[model samples]
Target chain A: MVPSEAKKYLSKEQFIHQAFSYLEKGVEPTVKTLWLNDEIQEKITEILEHSYPKLRLRYWQHDDQTVWFLDEIGKERPISFGISVKSQRINLVKVLEFRESRGGEIHMQAFTEQFDQIKLTDDNKLNKHIDGITGATMSVSAMKKIARVALMLDKEVR
Target chain B: MKFKLALVSAALLACGTVNAAEPTNQELLDLIKSQQKEIENLKKSVEEADEKAEASVEAAEKTMSNAADSKLSFGGYGELHYNNIEDKESIDFHRFVTFMGYEFNEDIRFFSELEVEHSLSGDGKPGEVELEQAYVEIDVTDATSIKSGLFLVPVGILNETHEPPTFYGVERNPVEKNIIPSTWWEAGAGVTTELAAGITADFAIHSGLEVPNDGGVYDFNIRSGRQKVAKANADSFAYTARIKYTAIPGLELAASIQHQTDLTQGVLNADANLYTAHAIYNVDGFGIRALYAGWDVDSEQAELAGQDKQDGFFVEPSYRFNDEFGVFARYSEWDNVAGNSIDTEMEQTNVGFNYWPHQNVVFKFDLERRDGAQDGDGFNLGVGYQF
Candidate 1:
C-alpha cells in the first residue's frame, strides 16, 4: 500500500476510520466483501484475460463511498490498486503497490488522475477515455479493468 | 398460503368430508399450522443465505491469502494458421509460448518467455524452441528502469508486444519481418526513462547480428542473422536508442537508431546502422499505423554484392467495429538489395478482419496480394489466444 499516499486522503475525513484501523498504524483495515452474482461474474471475466478467481470482492465502505483494494496480473505480477468510488464515480484511484519493474509510472499521480470522476456506462465501459502510458499498455489496461470492476461493484453494495 | 389451504381442502375431500358453507375449527386450525410452517421455512432459507454469504467472503479471503504466497505469475499466447498460396494449401501451428515472471520485490522482478515455433524442434524438423526473453529488471528510480540478460530489443512495435490477438492479420506484416526483423531479441542491458511530459527514451547495448559473409543472394539477410543468444559471438556489439512521444491521448510517435560495430562480428569489415520511425494514432474505432525502417551497411564487399542498403515501409489503416471485431488493410514494400538500384523490391497489399470472441482470443482471416519479386496471391486463416 502507498502509506503516505493513501494516508494523505484517508485523513481528510473521506471515510471514518475505526480505532482498529489506526491501532496498528494503518496496518490493518476493516475489510468487507461484495458477493458476486451471475452478471458481475460475467463482467469480471470479460475484463480479465483469465477467469476472475475470487467469487467475492473485499472492500471498505462508509456511507455511499467505498474503497476497493483490487489486484490484477499485469504481464506477470499482481499490480495492486486502491480505488475509491463515490456517487457511482471514481473519486480516487491510486496504484497502491506495483511489483513489476516496468510500468511503475502508473503509480504516478499524473496517470492515476485520469480516473477522477470516471463513471461506468450502462454496458460496463468507462465513460471517460484513459490515456495509456508508453511501453506500459498492459499495466494501463489492468488499472482500467480494476476501476471498472470497482464502479460496477459500488453499484452493488452501495 | 393459498397452496397450503388447497392441500388442506384436498385432505378433507380425501377423508370423505365435504363442506359447502363453512369450515369447522379443526380445519381452520390445520390451515393456521401449515401457514406457520411455511413462514418458518422461509425464515430458515434467509438464514441459510446469510450463512452462505459469510462463507463466500471467507473463501475469497482464503484465496487472497493463498495468492500472496505465490509471487510468480503465468500467461501465454499461441497462434495456429493455414495458408493457401497459389492454390497450394498447408497448415501449421505457427507458435506456442508459455511466459512467466516472478516479483522479488516492488522494484525488482524477473520475466521470461519460452517460445516454441513451428510446432517441433529437432535436427531436421521445421521448428525451434527458443527462449525469446529472459531478463531481470530493476527500477533505479520512479522514472527509470534497467533490464539485463536476454531481452527483446526495443527497436520496433511488434518486437516487444507481439501477442497474436494484439495485432491484425493472420501473419505479421512483411515489412517488420524482412526489414526490422521483429520477434528479435538479444542478450543485453537496456535503460528506459521518461525524458519529459509524454516523452520516453530507451538505450541498450546488446549482442549484435552476424549476417553470413559468404557470398550469395542472401548474403545480407538481416532476418537470418539473429544469433538468438545461443553461444553468440561477442567480437562486436550493437547499440540502439529510441525516443517516443505519446502525450497525445491517441497518438504515438517514435524514432529509433541503431549501430553495429561489425555486422559479421569481425568476419568481414562491415559496419551497419539502422534507422526506424513509426507512428500510431487510434481514436474511437478508427486507427492508422505507419513505420519506416532501413539499414545502411559500409563494406565494399556488401556494396559489390548489392546488399549494402536495405529498407521498407508499411502503412496500415484499421477500423474497429467494436471491442470484438475490427478490419485492417496494409500496403508494404521492402528490399534486401537496394544497393543494386534495379528496383528489386517486394510489394504487398493485405486486407484482414479480426474477430475477438474475447479480448485475448481472436479469429483472424486475411487475403494477401504480392506484386513484386515473389508473384503469388494467398489467403490465410488463423485463430489465436492468450491468457
Candidate 2:
C-alpha cells in the first residue's frame, strides 16, 4: 500500500492497523462476511430501537480465530466503529468515523480504550463498566450496542 | 492418508535396494525442499487475493454510505392541546410542523421548518400557516458554521429544539412564553462556533421587533411583538448574543442578551433590551430546570402604559420512573405590568405527568393554579409526537 494513500482517511487506517497488530508473525488473516439473519437483525433492532437498512457484515479472522468485528451504527447518522475480540474478551475498540455534530468525543482514545478486556456477562451484557460522554448520550449508547453485537457474533461464528 | 501410505511403501523399497537402483539422501532432501517452496508460493497468492477482495468490499461500502448521507432528510413534530379553565374549555390542535433538510455537499446545506397553527386557516377561522425557520448553513471550519435567512433567535433553549416529544410538560412553561417570548424567529444571519470544549457561542443580527403605537390590546403584551418575518418592518435592527456551557455531564447553563434599537420601529421613542439565564440538570431519571428572564423598555410611552421592566422566573423539577412514565411540578411568577404603581404580579403552580408510548410519542396531563388579580385554576391535556 502507498503511504500517501493511508493518510487520506487517517482514522480508518488507524483502526485497521490496531486490529491487525494483535496477530503473530506471518499469520495471514482472511475476511469472513455474513448476512444478517432474522434473529440477528431482531436483536440489533431491539438494542438500537431502530431498524438498520443494510443486511451484511464483514469480519476478519486469522487461523480460525476471530480477530475483529467491524460495523457501522447510526445515532443521527452512521458512525463507523470496530471491535477486536480475543479468547471471548474484547481486546480493543475503535471509532473509525464519527459523523454526528455532537458526540465526536466518543472517538477519543480515552473513551474507546475502556472497552478493552471487557467480556459478556451471563445475561449477555457487557461485563465491564463504561463511562458516558456529556451531551453525547445517544452516541455512547450506540457504541455499547455495537460492542454487545460484536461479542455475540464472535461466539456464534466460533 | 493415501499419500502417506505411498511414501512409506516407496521408502521401504528404496531401503531394500540400498546398493541397487535407489534415490540418494541428498536428492530426497532436495525434493522435499521444492514441495515446501511451491506451497509457500500458493499461500502468498491466496493472501493477496483475499486482501484485494477485502479492499473492494470496503470501497463499495464507503461509496454506498456516502450516497446515503447525501440524500434529502425529512422529519417533523406536532401537538394537540386541550385546556379547561375556570371560565372556558377549549380543544385545539395547536401545531403541525414539518422539517426538511438537504445537504448540498459536505460543507453546505439547507434546512427549514413549516408549521400550521390552530389546525385551520380560513376567512373566519383563527389559524395560520407559517415558516418557523429556513436557513442555508455553510461550515466555515470543523468547529464553526455560518447561517443566513429566517432562523430562530438564539435567546432561549426551546426556540431551536422544541419538538413536542422532547420537552417535559403539557403546555410550554409560561415563563418562557410570556417573558423570553419563545417560538420566536426572525429574518437574520448568524455565526455559531464552539468556543471551547463543551462551550458554544452564537451571535446574530436580525430584523427587530415592530411594536405598533396604536395603543391597542397588544400594547403591553411583549409576546405580541414578534413580526415572524412576515413582511416585517426593518426600520431598526436587533442584535442577539448567547453562550452555553455543558462541559459537565447532566448540567447545562446558558445566558442570552438581545437589544432592539427601536421596539416601536421609530413610531414611538422606544428601545428595548432582554436578558435571560437558564440551567438544566438531567441525571439518571431526575431532572430540574430553572430560568429567569426580564425585559427593559426605555420609553416614556411604554412607562405610561405600565409596560416597562417586565420580568418572570420559573423552576421545574421532574422524575421519570422509566422511559415511558414521568411526573413533574413547576412554580412560576411574573408581571408584565411591573412598572405600574399598583402591583400586578401573577403567580402560578403546575403539576403534570407524561406517558410516552414510544420515544417519539407522548401523552401529557397537567393541573395548574393561578393566583393574584386573575385568580383561577385549570387543567390541560396534550398528545404530541415527532418523526
Candidate 3:
C-alpha cells in the first residue's frame, strides 16, 4: 500500500474523518484506514516531532459476532471520535476526557448518508465536556481525537 | 643607563644588525627595543578582547536554550478534619490529607496526594495513609492539557477540587463521598479545556477495579486482579466525563458521569455507572454549595456494598464572620435501593466554626449527627495547612 497517497490528501485529522465518513456512508473501511494512520504518524513526526505522532483506532465488537469500527480515538485524555458499522449502518460517537477535572464529557448523534463527519457534539454538550473551560472547543475536540486515536492504535496491534 | 645601552647593542648584533654607533646612537637603539616589547604586549591584549566578545555572543544564544528546558517546582497542601456527633453512640472522627506536587514546566508536571484517615494507617487505628491522587500531566496549552497515570475524575466539587480550607466543615458532603465517591482517583489520562466564559470541561478513561464490598482494600492494588483501561478488544477500561461552569464568579456548577464494563468477568459481573451534579456559590463571604450523585451496579459483588441505585444530595451554607472567624452548617442525605442489603437511607447534619490566623493555616471545630444507617456520630476539632 502506498502510504504517501493517504498522507497527501489527509491530515491525520482527515484520515480519522474519512474513517467516520465511510462508516456514515454505509461503506466499510478497508484495513487501509489503519495504514493511513501509521503513514500520517510518520509524516507528522518528520514535521512536528515534539507533538504526539501516533493515531489509534477503535471498533465495537458485540456478543453476536457483529463487528463495528469505532470512530472514537481513545478513552483517555485527549478526546476522540467513535465509529461503528453494523447491518449497513455506521454509528459515530464523540467522547471527551480531561486530566484533573471530572465529568466533562460530550457525545454527539450518529451521522449517516450525506453529512460529513465534521460535526461536533453540540455547544451544550461541549460546554459540559469542558467543565469550566471557555472558548476552546476546537482544542478540546482535537484532544478527544488524540485520546481516541491512541486507544484505537493500541487496539489494532493487540 | 650605560649598562642598558651596552645590552641593546649586543642584542642587535646577535640579530644580524650592525651597531656602528656613538654613545647617543646606543641610547636610540635601546628605545627602539623597548617599543618592540610594548607592541607584543598590545597584540596579546587585543587577542584576549576578541575571545571575550565571542564568548558573550555564545552566552546570548544560550538564554532561550534554558527557557525550553523544563523548570522544576514543588508545592503541597493538606487537610485536617474533625467531627463531633450529638448522638450518645457517636465517635469523633479526625483525618489528614496532604498533597505534594512537582511541576517540571508549563508543559508537564507530577502531583500526588496522600491521605491518612483518622490519623492512622491501620485496620483499626486512629488513621490510615494512602496515596490518594498520583499522576503526570502534559499541558499542550492553557486551554488544553493531557494527563495520565492515576488521578481524580472531575465529576463533582469534592472529587478533584477538594482542599481542606475550600470546604466548610470536617468531612466532605455525603452526596459527594458515598454517592459520587470523594477522593476517588483512578489510573488514566484525559484532557481539560475551556468552553466559554466561566466554563471548563474534562473527561478521562481510567483503570476500574472490581472490589466487592467484602473485598479488602488490598484487593485494589494486586496484579491480574486489576484492569488496564484499554482502547478496543481489551478486557478492562472505564470511561469518564465531566463539565463545569463558573459564570457566577464565586458560584461554580458542574455535572459528571462514569461507566465501566464487567470488571471481574465472574458470575453476575455487570456494568457500573455513576452520575452527579454539583454547585457552589459564594456571595460576600456567605458561601453555599450543593451536590447530587447516583451510582448503579449490576454485579453480584454489589450486594456487599449495598450497591443498587443509590442517590444522594447535600446542601451547605457558611458565613464568614470576619477574615479569621466563620460559622457553617451542612445537611446531607443518601438512599440505597438496589442490591441484597435491602433499602437503606442515611442523613447527616453538621455545624462548625473555622478560624484562620494565617493564610496557609486553619483551625476548625465541627459537631455532626447521623441517623438511620451507620448510626454513629461525634464532634471533633482540627487544624490544617497548605503550602
Candidate 4:
C-alpha cells in the first residue's frame, strides 16, 4: 500500500507544482506529450521482460530550453522520481515518492544532490560517478537512470 | 533669350522638389507587405525546428526508460561461526547465500536465493547446498500480491528477511529455530495483502510435515520434520496464515497459526496445530523483542512417547551505543515433551555484542549458559556480511 505521506507526492499536479518551484521565474509551464516508437518500446520490453507500458511521456518545457521529466520507476515497487534539466545539465533529481518498507534514505538530499550538474556522455550514460547507497542499491540505480535520461532528453531538445 | 532660359530652369527645379518631397500611398503599402512576408517565413522555420527537437527528445527518453526498467539485480549474505563449549572448541563456515532477482515489469517479478551451509555439500559430508527460496510474485494492486513456488512461510520475522547483517546475535533466537521452526520454506502458493495501514495479512497452502510416529531420534523434534520440498509427502497438506502490524514506527506485533491434518501424512491418526505470537519495539537506540510459540499434537502414539506438546518463549533487550556498536541479552525456555509428567523444561541465557564497521558487515561475540537435564556453557564468535 502507498504510504500516507507518499500519496501527496504521487499526483501529476503535485509533480508540476514541485517542478515550477524549481524554475527561476515560477512560470506555469504547459504539458507536452511524446509518444514512443516500436524500437524503444521493444528495448524496454527486453529489459522488463514484460510488455512495456504506454510510452506517452508527459513533461513540461520552459522557454524551449529547459525540460522537466517526471515518471515512476520500479525498485521492488514503483517509486516516483523527478528530474529537471537546463542546457544539458541536471539541475535537480529528487525522489518524489517512495513506497518500499525500507530504503527511504534514497530521498534524502545527501543522496539526491549527487546528480546535480551531472551530464550524460556520448554513449548516453552519466558522465559523473555516483556512489551506491548501502541497502538502497535498487533505489540508487533507478535514480541514476532518471538522471541519464533527463540529460539525454535535454540535449536533444536544445 | 536669357530670361526665357531662367524661367525654364526655375520650372524644372520646382518639379524635381515636388517629386522628391514624399512617396505615394501605394509605395508605402508595398514596403510593409514585403516585411510581413519575411517575418512569416522566420516564424514558420522556428516552429518546424521546435517540433523536430521535441520528437528527438521523446525518442531518446523512451529508449532510456526501457533500459532502466529491464535491469537485473544481485545481492547476498554470508557468515562464519566459531563455538567454544566447556574446554572443547570448534569452528565452522556456517552459511553463504546469494540473492538474485529480475523485474518482468512493474507488476510481476522473479526472486531466488541459493545457499551453502557448513561450507560444503557432497557424499558423506556434514555440509549441504540448498535453494532457500525461489518464487514469482504478481502484484494485483498497490496493496496486494500473490506468490508461488518454494517460499518461506510467513510465520516468523526472521524467516523472510533472515540475512545475518539485518538482525542481531551470533545465531538466531533458539525459540524461533526450534519451536517456530524458522528458516523453513515449503512448496507453497499464497496471497499477501496490506489489509490496512501498517497491517499485512498472508495465507498459504503447502506441503505438510511427516513426523515419525515411532518416536525415535526424530520423534518430537519439530525441526527434523522439515520436508525441504524434496520428495515431500503429499498425502496431506498444511495451511498457514499470519497477520502483522507495524503502524507504530519502531514497533511490530504479529501472530501466525498453522494446521496440518495429519503430521504423519496419514500413516498415523495424528494432527498438529502450531501457534506463534511476537512483538518487537525499538526507539532511541534501545530495543526489546519477545516471542512465544507452541505446537500441539493429537495422537495416541505421540502421547505414549511423551511427544504430544512442545512450546518455547524468549525475551531479548538490546542497546546500541552508536551505529557501529551494540549489545543485547536474551533469555529463552522450551519443553519439547510438555505432555510428559516429568520436569522437562530447558532454559538458556545469552549476552552478546555486535560491531559493524559497515552497515552490511558485522562482527559478533556472545556468552551463553544452559540449564536443564543436560547443562552447558559456551562462548560464540562470528562474522557476517551482505551486499
Best of the candidates, lDDT: 1
How do the residues B120-192 of candidate 2 rate in per-residue lDDT, one tens digit apiece?
9888998989999898888787678888999989876677667776677778888789887889999989998
Q: Which window of 10 residues has the lowest lDDT sum in candidate 4 chain A? A: A1-10
Candidate 1: how many backbone clashes?
A: 0
- iRMSD in angstroms, per model: 6.4, 8.5, 15.8, 9.8
True contacts kept of 3: 0.00
Model 1 residue B258 lDDT score:
96
- Number of the predicted model whose TM-score against the real structure is largest: 2
Model 1 over residues A1-158: C-alpha lDDT tens digits?
Answer: 11000112223233324212333554544468676677777877776644566666767765567777677866555777778887899988877666554455676667778889999988889997676654566788899999998887888776
> Candidate 2's residue-wise lDDT over A1-158, tens digit each?
00000001136446556677766787656777767778877776765564445556777776534554444443345676767777788887877666665565676666777788888887678886565554465577778878887887788778
Q: Is candidate 3 or candidate 4 better by DockQ?
A: 4
For model 3 chain B, give the 10-residue run with minimal summed lDDT. Answer: B219-228
Measured against the true structure, the TM-scores of the candidates, in listed sequence, are 0.77, 0.79, 0.52, 0.70
Give the per-residue lDDT digits (tens) of candidate 3, residues A72-134. Answer: 111112232333333223333333222222223233111112112222232211111222122
What would you estimate as the lDDT of candidate 1? 0.81
User: How far out, in Å, is residue A140 in model 1?
Assistant: 3.7
Which is the winner by TM-score between candidate 1 and candidate 3? 1
lDDT of model 2 at position A134: 42
| Candidate 4: residue B322 Cα off by (Å) | 3.1
